[model samples]
Target: MSSYDFVVIGSGPAGRRAAIQAAKLKKSVLVIDDRGSVGGVSVHTGTIPSKTLRESVLNLTGWRERQFYNRRSTDNPQTNCAALNSRLSKTLLHEVDILEQQFARNNVHTLQGRATFVDKNTLRVERREADRTAVELVTAERVLVTVGTKPFRPDNIPFNNRTVLDSDAIVSDLTIPKSLTVIGAGVIGIEYATIFSALDVPVTLVEPRDSFLDFVDREVISNFTQQLLDRGMSIRLGCSAESIVLDENDWPVVTLSDGRVVRSEMLLFAAGRKGATDDLGLENLSLEADHRGRLEVNPKTMQTKVDNIYAAGDVIGFPSLASTSMEQGRIAACHAFNAPMPDAPHHFPYGIYAVPEISTIGYSEEEAKAKGLLFECGVARLRETSRGHIMGLQSGILKCLFELKTGKLLGVHVVGEGATELVHVGQAVLNLGGGIDFFMENTFNYPTLAEAYKIAALDAWNRMAHERSGKVIKLKKRKVGKKAA
Candidate 1:
């Protein structure tokens, strides 16, 4: 039987990262996955595929041309799905190949098989290839289970290959509908809506909520809503598809909960994702999943009920991005080895790949109030910055929250160009326990979006001054007056 110091199941972001981290520490590692390829959903269905399509749409359809030059001015403004798919596929495959090479360089053994828990210290690995064979495997003392999530498909929906599709199916070029109906206004839904809409395919987005992106700041969502509307996308919030039927033309006809009937060439259910822990004999190990089939991991160490078996990524659920999952995987591996590692970052960024991106780190405004902390909000619109003006940014905003009493930076939220990139500044500040004073004193590049952090800090300082009572004002002046003044 093959053996290693560490065996990571599922070669996704979390598993791959965990293996790499362990390998870096001179641990023999084996990474097993069911898929024939590497890089997991991030490379295949989720991050790379979507972002590549977004970029392809922007370039081919001249969406970015509309920034400085109008689409009408482009020699060829129309885009085709085949072209976007061809490019996206090529790039995605190259990325997966590179990741495979990296694993090889690190001497991490990748086994193409399905792994099942024989016991806490043993696994039964069924190898799948030209000559299939079952092999009894002995598990390592430390195991990292980073099996990610899969797109949730509900039984109520009639999901025929032609008329209805899931997120994974859309990655293939087979069903590029002329007009599409997308359910769920969460990140995936909004992203697909924007992508298809950008391709000039009429898209109708339905959500069973009063607002889109409710988790994000309201102003940011409003701006995104405006952008999507401008692109000729239809949004129906507080409405859900009661039933879906295929027309004689093999198109999808959906009846909403509000008694509204909508027809589309295709229907995409981006409802959400569920953990990938269903079939790995989790029950045998006495591990249980919640309603969403996600493991309840210790937020501190990411260990499941069984201390030796650690879970990370979407399997554990929430903040389920490739970047965060990578970090969690590395941390889990470190914890498994009992390696001396620094504390996890206090603030982690959340990125939603909608038309206009949304990203945030740290506490939300409501969370601050719920915690009964004295806080102030600072806001800056992208239009207010010269960089935004030069880039033709029509709508985008950055909001910062700070602890009023101690001047500690609480949160940073943004929706606009480079929202994901801009969140790092806030992350650094939050990690260091830096406050509004740090932002106000620092000088950012001229006419840059990063200036929003400074502007937001000043805004918070002004509000803190206004909200403080006489006694509080004296305390603030005595401590932070030099910086604010």
Candidate 2:
């Protein structure tokens, strides 16, 4: 029998970060995950692989140069699969190696096995070694369940790992289809659909809803939706696949609720994901997950109904980005150990690694209205930036929303090249409660896309003044750390 101060189940972003945080506080930490599954979905199937594939597609297809050169690099037969997978394989290995090193450096013990709850405080790990299996029971004062999630495969989908696939299977099994049809307009579905379209593959996106990405500002979505249309990607909304059957060529033929028949060489169902908690033995603790297999937890502390049990990551649902999950894990571990920690974040950034990329922080325009807050929207197109021209970008925008009366920065939204990286500057300003004045007054590098913030702020400044409210006060820049000259 082995015991530890903190026993983290799953070695994904959440579990790994929580275990390390506890270890730093001098607690005995053990992280349990299935054999060879250290990096979880993020590294293996979700975030890393998808982003790498996007990068590979861009490079091979000369996507970045298409605007300026108007000519693409010659297509290589190997690019269909070999070229993309080669880089992905190398990247995954390096990422896992670094994760293992972090564990070893922090003295965070990791056990390879399927972990199950023996009780609220005890866990049974069934370890498989070659032809034999070993079972071990471990006890901990606090236990964290962060097993993450798996793709939701419907019984009727008829996935064959060839003509039909799920988001998880596509990470390794995907070959550039002659024509691809993706069901679902959620982040994962849009990402894969756009990625293949970037390679000049004919991609048709089918969603049951009339609109998708409802959390994003409508203007941003309009821009993104237009981009997809311009790229020859077909979108079917307000309907669902009534039935999917294989044709004479073994291709997927999908009939929609609207009486539309769509046939594609391949179909990808990325409608949703379910929590990987079914086999976790949560019933022993009288814990139940929602219909989607998501756990209910105190958002403040990430604690489950059971006092000593906590859950984080996708298992708990919403804002399931690996970035947020890491922070949640850290917070959960600190609270479990009664360690002093920073207050919860004011907001978190959402990045969708699609063709052009979309990122947002804080309240979106729709959210602001729903909350009954008055806000002003300021927008700047990337084409106005010299950097955009240098990079041959034809479309991109940075939008800022300010509290109408006080000029307080309420949100930032962007859709374009490098939008994910660009949103951080806005995130910092929003977190500090900085307003439009900060953007107008701050000195950003010349000829950079960041200048869009200034352009946008000035636009909002004009509007705020039009309302004849909120005086712009000149403030001095304070150098906090450096010695004065």
Candidate 3:
């Protein structure tokens, strides 16, 4: 038996960050993961793998170049499962190696095993070597559970990993089909659907909700929807999968509740994901996970019911991006060790890597209206910029919202190329409490997508000036009418 200051289970983004943070504080840290390697799901199956695959598809198929060329020929490069797998493999290996080295340098010990709670303070890890099985019991002053989540596989869906697959299997199997039917319009489904569609494979996206990406700004969503439609992807809204059956040829035929049948060479069911906590023996700690297998934690502190135990990332649920998860892990480690935690910003940017790409931070017009905030909006189309002309991008938008009275920037939303990377400028302003004036005052590099910020700011400034002038004229008219009366 060995004892340490902190023990982190599952070396995903959250676990890795927490362990390293604690170790940096000179605390003895042990990280336990079943995968036999660092980087966990984020590096292996989820974020890195999917994003790398998207980049590979875009590069290999000349997706970005197609806007200008418009040439369709057999000589054009095509991507297959092998090529994508090769890229994903290389990327994952590099990421894992970096994480492993980081852990070693920080003096954080890592054990490859499945971790189960012996009690609130102790963990029993099971490991298997080539010819022997071993068990190790480790005690810790604090524990962080960051096991992440797995794709929800419903029994009704016949997943053969060839014709039909879940989100995880889709990346591993890596087959390019003639047609694909993706169930669930969530982030994962939308990403894969668009990736395959970009490859010129007919894709049908089915969502049970009437709205797609409802959390995103409606304007951004509208633009993204149009981009998908323009790319020839079929979107079926407010439709649920009644059943998935195989035809005589053994291809998947998805029956919708709306009396529609969609037959595709392959199917991807990415409805949702559940936390990977089934084997952690939470019952021993008297901790109850939600129906989705997610553990509840204090939003600010990331602490569970047990004061010393914390949870982060997908296992804790909501805003499960690698970026946010890393922050959560750092905050959790800080709280666990009683370190001074910095104040987190009220707003964080959300990035969706769909075909056209969407990124947003702060409030949307609809949200501002719902909250009864006095707000005005400014809009700029990418086509209005020089960069858009050079890149042949006709469809892209940068929308900015400002509070009418104070001229404070309420939100920034963007859709189209480079939206994800370009959103950081908005995030910086929002975090620093800077308003529209910041964009108007600063000079962005000319002929760049970033210049859209300045354009949007000017639009809002003009609108505000016009409204103010109109109000003054109305006041003068009212005074004149009162004097005549």
Best by TM-score: 2
Q: Write the per-residue lDDT of candidate 1 for residues 218-269, one digit (tens) a residue.
A: 6567777887888789899999889998889988999999999999999999
Quality of model 2 by C-alpha lDDT? 0.90
List the candidates' TM-scores in order.
0.91, 0.96, 0.95
- Candidate 1 stretches with Cα past 4 Å from truth are 72-79, 131-138, 464-485
Q: Specify the poorest-scoring 10-residue window by lDDT in model 1.
A: 474-483
C-alpha displacement of 215 in model 3, angstroms? Answer: 0.7
State which candidate, 2 or 3, has the greater lDDT: 2
lDDT of 3 by residue, 1-485 (tens): 99999999989999988999999899999999899678888987899888998888887777777779984323222346677788888998999999999999999999999999989999999999889989999999999999999999989899888899998898875878879999999999999999888888899999999998888889888888988898789999999999899998779998899999999999999999999999999999999999989999999999999988999999999999888999999999999999999988899999888777889999998999999999889888998888888888889899999888777889999998899999999999988887876777676777899989888877877787756755331221211111111
How would the candidate models be sorted by lDDT, starting from the highest?
A: 2, 3, 1
User: In model 3, what are the clashing residue pairs, if there are any?
Assistant: none
Residue pairs in collision within model 1:
none
Clashes of each: 0, 0, 0
Candidate 2 residue lDDT tens string, 37-95: 58888898889999999999899888999987786535764565888889899999998
Query: Per-residue lDDT for 443 in model 2?
Result: 76
Best by lDDT: 2
